[model samples]
Target: MSSIANTDEPAAATAQGHGHSASTLTLAVGAVGVVFGDIGTSPLYAFRETFAAHHGAIGITPDAEHIHGVLSLVFWSMMMVVTVKYVLTIMRADNKGEGGSLALLALIRRASDNRRWTAPLILLGVFATALFYGDSMITPAISVLSATEGLQYIVPGFKPWIVPTAVAILFGLFAIQSRGSGKVGKLFGPIMLTYFGMLATLGVMHLSANPAIILETINPINALRFFQADGFTAFIALGSVVLAVTGAEALYADMGHFGRKPIGLSWLTFVFPALMLNYMGQGAMILSASSPAAAAALVKDPFFLMIPDLVRVPVIILALLATIIASQAVISGAFSLTQQAIQLGFIPRMEIRHTSASAAGQIYIPTINWGLMVMVILLVLFFQSSTNLAAAYGIAVTGAMFIDTLLLAAVLFSLWRWPVWKALPLVAAFLIVDVAYFGANLIKVPQGGWVPLLIGFVIFTLLTTWSRGRELMRASMSESALPIEIFAKSAQNSATRVAGTAVFMASTNTGVPSALLHNIKHNKVLHERILILTVAVQDVPYLESIERYSCKDLGNGFYRVTIRCGFLEETDVPALLRTLDLCGAPFDMMHTSFFLSRQTLLASAKPGMAIWREKLFAWMLRNAASAMEFFRLPTNRVVELGSQVEI
Candidate 1:
């Protein structure tokens, strides 16, 4: 509200395809590759783990009723969660063509100017983001492990080699991230297309053997009957049933990458049909088994068993490739989320490397990539099998989904202004399903569900600490900040005028920068033409070049310039300055000196945060990337003025 402009108009325009030029078919293909990858690979372990005897929750029998019931549950879960809630509903809530918790938070804040609700909404958004880190780490581990576990179906001896093989594959995946995904990204669409086709073909072959399974699965009565018969056990199965829709968040998270229509079309035309057929076919195969013992064995790895013996090796190879693609989606999403966090002031700025020449969203964060690799390898080594990892999976996803329902309620009530009767019933239905899944996963905490929750808590603490600490630090600095008019008059009377132009970076537009005061007090000199510049990150993804900078003349050879950047765009101060012809003088690199303030934070017995948190925030601030690199300032002509601040 100080220097930040309203991003609603620009964000809405971008969401409407203002910047994108891709054809509907092309974007749809891309969506299938990236947006659908996580959910696409769930067939590997969702059904198997649901009835695993080790869990002792849901028991699998060879009877048609049991098989049909599970199939119906999976089918309807996808329809309600993925198709209805996400694809059709949440996708429509895009913030200027962007999705995910943070983007949605910004949209909600902009929609309602209610100061009382702002902080609580921000906390919800931050926690949702924290849970996403858990999802990101678990996704790659489980996806790769499950895909490689297919080796047990081919050679029994390969059982011993699964973990090692997955580790090697994961290391390779993380290693190639620095080079970016542009080259390999093109192959993703075609490879995933082939993978989906194979899924349909295998399912079709099995469905032919027992055509009646499809009819039984299509009916809603089986799901109702299963719940009624199994009671508590069926409720427990909801945790595992949620696996089928594990990557449902990706649909909304990645809406900015591919448009809404493309994602919806891809799901409706190809991905949805392929997944439904395969799941139903697995049910049919188990139901039509020769005996109960045989069916029990097949359910352990139903996805691999669905293929013919002769072609199992080829299919397994295809599955492995598909899983790699799936892992890539979340890894890329992690990088995008971190960038958003930094721009939104929830985290410290980190080094961001643009990987693609044409695509602005394509970026690589070295710290995040290596950190994820280490965590993923540790998980694979610890869990050893996808079955073990499955226990840790659903909690993060369900937690995030539950939070999403809350945010969507805000969107319905405040943003969309939907009628009370219409919104209440729809939101209530979604909350019932979301709460059921979340509660079932909560039961798994004693077993392995604690992993994600623990990770989320740590991350949530770090995020909130940094955010609050920054606010306190800003307040402390603002208390001593001199008004620009007073500082300008003092400088004009007391300081010696130098030969070149000086740009002092200010945190807020209303105050004279600390660096300028320090330079004048110590050096006793100032440049002939002085400028106070403040860089404000807008709540949008990208800003137009013409709307990038606003200049105000403050009199006496002084000007106040505020540069606005979208979260997704690069913040190069010099480049933006050079393009401003209306700022009186053309920017010259050789004649400019940039002044910056480097604050040495002292964590006092402050009331703003706990002592432990203040220390953590201080450590983070010390290790944050330098402003010169982050703002693309020239190193040769820059001067850093150090100051001590207690917060």
Candidate 2:
């Protein structure tokens, strides 16, 4: 019942699993691969758009002061928002060192004392999750497009071929997923390492030309001036610019994989400074240039423009590698989100296969992987340019950020048991920052924000429907299960004598299984002893063996056994039973027959969904991998009884 028992010690206690702690440097490097990939590559297109896009173009002063000021805003925004707000403060709010929107939701849900607001809390989470799907699609499009567009910087004639070539490269990227990313991941760290070195070198070279940019970063006056100049305009530009820091969330989401210390250190020491210097460098480049032709020099390739032409080829290659790494991070995030959704019961269980044997968390969900790949490919093909894809990117990332702030408030007030006086200020500050970004992103809806908004709404509806429908189904099944006390008395007296154990899988510990009801209705008999074994999959991902199962003996030798499994773990009944003490419970193999209940969904003339959705749901149910196979139960011992249900 304790929170620690539910979280920390399950698989390790059972398998003698030992976790190896990564050294500080190794963790920092690895964190770059996992956490900062998306945002790391943002410099490729973020600033270029500012000079060329609507807001930037409207007030295109093309001066060093405003460019310095704009870059100053970016530098400090990363420092204040990404590094300070998230890496320093929010990362510490990790759910057992596992970060992400879900982890934050779970922790807050568990900790909150008030039940009244639970509904809205869950809705907020569902919306955030919905938004992420949009983020997933846009990340690949923008990353690949931006990198591939850089080719034109070197070869102007290649401009006509950029879109088609980018599409082809993305197709190949998605095509190779089944082979897994073990080798690709190995190269990710080294490539990002080179990319960071180039970033630092670019910054150093540009800063030597105009050291005054360093003074702007330190002064904070430029940031104030930039904001005060056109507060409303600056606020609107932030919606898109925030995309540059979207991967800030990954710092926390990936905390479990790389640990908090590494992410914290990387943000403060290497990533933050490199990002600031480069932005400032870009600002300086924009400042000195004259004319759109010369501005073309700065805008054509902001990421590589600071470097000499001799080294541009190598920078271009590194940019490609960084984008690949970024896409991989988003793909991994999609897997983690699906896993959490399954455990939380917002979605049905899917085939979750572990991609890496040694890492418990490195899983691959074929459903999500293929779904994202299709969407990503379509997005790249349609958008053709990073500028177009950028329009659709921010709603989901910022929406999720806003939800995190709300969840954090709940944590402070109820879960952490902080006083109202102390919680109010912290909550207020985050809300102001997060809500501004959320509002800024809202301005983008007509432009391209509608994509994520539509995705979010559709996903929210599905999640709500599934959660409601599952609850109703469970209630109906529970109502149908016979009370164990009455069944035990009758079975022992009147049923046929069986020499072995008869294990009926019950949905509840206090009742006979529905499969047994079907069996008795058809055959007019029940097995001797009638072991009513019930299984409860907990909300959390792991449970201890000692806490794995519990038994209650009904009268006349009918025993009710309940087994617990984490969300990430598959149910293996035989393996679970082997670990049980059984408490002198009789179990002869010849007599033991495992009974399972399989729901056969029926389409009704009565109103629920339209004919199309019913047919779609039916197809989904039929194509779904069998539950028996999913649980890894033995075919011979398992006997399934089908029942009809209308949803």
TM-score (all chains, Cα) for each model: 0.97, 0.90
lDDT of 1 by residue, 1-647 (tens): 11222233333343322245889999999998898899999988998877774355646554787778888889888888889999989889987788999989888876677568777887999999999999999999999999999988888899899999999999999999999998999999999999998989889989999888888887889999988988888888888889999999999999988888999999999998999899888887887788989999888889999999889999999999999999999999999999899888887878889999888788999989999999999999988999889889999999999899899999998889999999999899899999999998998898789999999999999899887888888888889888899888878889889888899887777787888889999999988888888888777776767677789887778999888787777777899889877567798989999998888889899688888888898899898888888888898989999888899
RMSD of candidate 2 to the true fold?
4.1
lDDT value, candidate 1, whole model: 0.87
**Cα lDDT of all candidates, in order?**
0.87, 0.72
Estimate, for each residue in 1-647, the C-alpha lDDT of model 2 and write its tens digit.
00001222223334211233869899899887778889888888877665555533363354665676667667766866787678877787866556777767766665554389976997897788888878888888899889998888788799789888887877787777766677678877878877877787787787777788788766668767867886776777777668768777778777777878888888788887887777777777766676756865666557767768988888897888789889988888888888777666667657777677766677777888888888887887777788887777888888888887887777777777799998898888878878887898787777778888888888777666655555545555566666778877776666566556667765456556667778877876665566676566554445557677777877676777777766555565676776676645545454467777777666666455665555555555565555555555577877888877765
Runs in model 2 deviating more than 4 A are: 1-20, 55-59, 290-293, 497-503, 506-510, 523-531, 555-557, 583-593, 602-623
Candidate 1 lDDT for residue 587: 86
Residue pairs with clashing backbones, model 2? 500-591, 501-591, 501-592
